[model samples]
Target: MLGIDCPKPKGRWPTAPFDPRFPKQNQTRNCYQNLLDYRPCVKRMRRRGKSTQPCEYYFRVFHALCPMSWVQRWTEIKDGTFAGKI
Candidate 1:
């Protein structure tokens, strides 16, 4: 997955999530590829005030870079957690 710069969809978030069973259709989604990409996006989005970006990207996969669980764990915290309070 290195050297890949996929394009993210623009405009309002999609009303539904891309089906994971058929990932190629959602392969363009370049989100949650790594902890580096996932944690920081979540961190900045959480810090952003009065915005829908967080909710949108939290569960939204971009170019299939990140996993759904990684995005869904936005609110997950505490010891031994994946990535939190960063």
Candidate 2:
């Protein structure tokens, strides 16, 4: 299941250089697009008996690549806690 609250950026966050070979290259797009890319892996995981765990892992990946604010909104929507416009 998704978490209710957004992830808070911790101290001493180091900026990493961008790499084109990263699997989640288009993660900077809107939530809808992000969901599109994530859904396939999620389905495959479920078919392999992973259940919702894979979805949670996707959320973690999104949180890691996206800004804290974006992660908060995404988490809210994923957890059914967001009811406003995106």
Candidate 3:
């Protein structure tokens, strides 16, 4: 979410403008926050009816916004041992 909402997410790609109401998505904070927002989306999608038929917009933005390896490091960095230390 993070102030950026995807277009109904047809198939090829997802595009959303940086929300002028808040910090831009290109920033690290907003990008990671977007990923966090997506954490709930997966479950909601399953409960409401999954959309596994196609790649969802959250993941598309995740890859577009940051590298996969960075995600691994983010997981490690978010662990209790590293929390608030960064």
Top lDDT hit: 3
Local distance difference test, candidate 2:
0.50
lDDT of each: 0.44, 0.50, 0.52
Per-prediction TM-score? 0.28, 0.35, 0.49
- Residue 71: error of model 1 in Å? 7.6
User: Residue by residue across 1-86, what tens digits does model 1's lDDT show?
Assistant: 21212235676655435556446755433353433454456546556754435444443444234555743453354434544233
lDDT of 2 by residue, 1-86 (tens): 34323235455544434445454746465434444446556656656877555465444455556777865455445543444322
- Candidate 2 stretches with Cα past 4 Å from truth are 1-27, 30-36, 51-61, 78-86
Count steric clashes of candidate 1: 10
Candidate 2 lowest-lDDT run of ten: 1-10
Flag the better candidate by TM-score, 1 or 2: 2
Question: Residue 3, candidate 2: how far off, in angstroms?
Answer: 9.6
Query: What is the TM-score ranking, best to worst?
Result: 3, 2, 1
Best by TM-score: 3
Residue by residue across 1-86, what tens digits does model 3's lDDT show? 22223335355655444645346545566556556656457556656787733335555665566666975565554334433321
